[model samples]
Target: MKLIFSIRSYDWIDYAAGLILSESDIYHVMILLKDDDGSMCDCKNFCSQAIYEQRKFDLFNVGKKLGVKKLINLGYDADEIDINKLTSQLQLYLMLSGVNEVYCQYSLPILEILKNICNKLNIKLYFYNIEDRKDEYLMVVGKEIRLSNDIINIKNNLSNLTIGRYTIVVNNETKERFYYIYKE
Candidate 1:
């Protein structure tokens, strides 16, 4: 499957890497950034400039290991484009490229935007939020899709994994959910 990742920082690195590594059917993975400098979001990152640079480098290195196929910058500064234009561009890109899934992290506004676009395109969108888990064990809840066998393998292989009860949520709700846990 083809996937698009809207990235902002290294916060989602472990989840992203885990998903990519576990899902062997991935054929093309595109890294989408909001700016040319590789720092994708307009939000303030907590680290120093030097540390930020290193994080970007480390992120790319991890992507290389995960076999990411393309890196694309949308080329929109904070003041350069409006939401309608951004939405249009994203819609056109995903429609043209036939992207099957979209993975996004860090920014809730961006996630909403992508969620709308993906819903329109009938593509599955997964939001990776590291802070949402209950404890040491990662939790996943999905509306449409189920946890794959690969995830089960990860759960079984890890000795340090904390057992936590998680239920797969399916309802008439419009939102979707997916969570991945892996040791770095």
Candidate 2:
């Protein structure tokens, strides 16, 4: 899946995927050692966290270890977010990718704009409020999507991925209701 995870911060890193793989915490990390003059800053692998850490990296194949094929990070200080810029950039980025689905947090007020952009691109964007579990809908999208089986399938897949820790959401309005598993 071509995915973009809106990361809160790098305090919790998913080193296994070299990017923010989850909205939760993980034990993985990546060290992009660079010269004092910033010569190795490739901007490809270096994501929002990498930039915050003063490092750079290739973000395209970041999720190979986590089952996500094309994952990108849109890191930000939620308290000081520029929603307009974020939305515009997000639309551009999605337009340039091969992504079929999107997982975004309803907490982001720009979700409406993001939804419109996704609609234009014919992409499936699933917005969820994971912070709360009593919502009527697991997702919020266009009317057309709300009436399709695509959303239902996404809900099921997300529930399975999260190990049944999610609710199906009757969606009086309406979301990953996803995480990776590993066996040692």
Candidate 3:
């Protein structure tokens, strides 16, 4: 069983199969709205328009013909229905349909929440890196004082040295350390 996540711009819609619906394979098609920020406004104002609505209807009709059991809307801010809550709801839906796998675009917070949900439901969540086409990387910094290896070596070798945005600290016994001002 497969689960599908639909992403339009920054909003995400997660869908799982239901007992009434059974599809062997699930496909996640991202609707790329041509606009700045492409928020819910895009879906409400533009997508709901007659022309776009027809297009969506056609797409859904085709998907139905192709045996798509569920359709999910993903990417919008879930302030009221946040990621954790949404995933919990989706987990129940997937469980009813016997879905085992989920496919989705990259949304770190949502992905993390979904991971937890999947763990609880014993389902596997799969993430597709859509941003890789632009060559982007996401980094998480754990500490403010963690310095690069080069900066550490330099601070260790020199009693007092200053590198770009880094301050080298040298101990009385000749131990070397690096420090940087907290950016806060």
Cα shift from native, residue 31, model 1 (Å):
6.2
Q: Identify the superior model by lDDT, candidate 1 or candidate 2.
A: 1
Give the least accurate 10-residue stretch of model 3, judged by summed lDDT.
158-167
Work out the TM-score per prediction.
0.56, 0.42, 0.45
What number of backbone clashes does candidate 3 have, counting pairs of residues 3 or more apart or in separate chains?
10
Per residue, candidate 1 scores C-alpha lDDT tens digits across 34-129 of 322322122234334444444446446555665666555454554555778777877888899878877666465677888888888899876655
Tens-place lDDT digits, model 2, residues 37-133: 2112222343434344432232212223344433333544446667678777777877775566665555446667667888999987754334343
Best by TM-score: 1
Q: What's the lDDT for all of these models?
A: 0.51, 0.39, 0.42
Write the residue-wise lDDT of candidate 3 on 2-33 in tens digits.
Answer: 65554442122112112113233554443323
Which residue runs does candidate 2 get wrong by more than 4 Å? Answer: 7-64, 134-184
Worst 10 residues of 2 by lDDT: 30-39
Model 3 misplaced stretches (Cα beyond 4 Å):
9-52, 74-81, 134-184
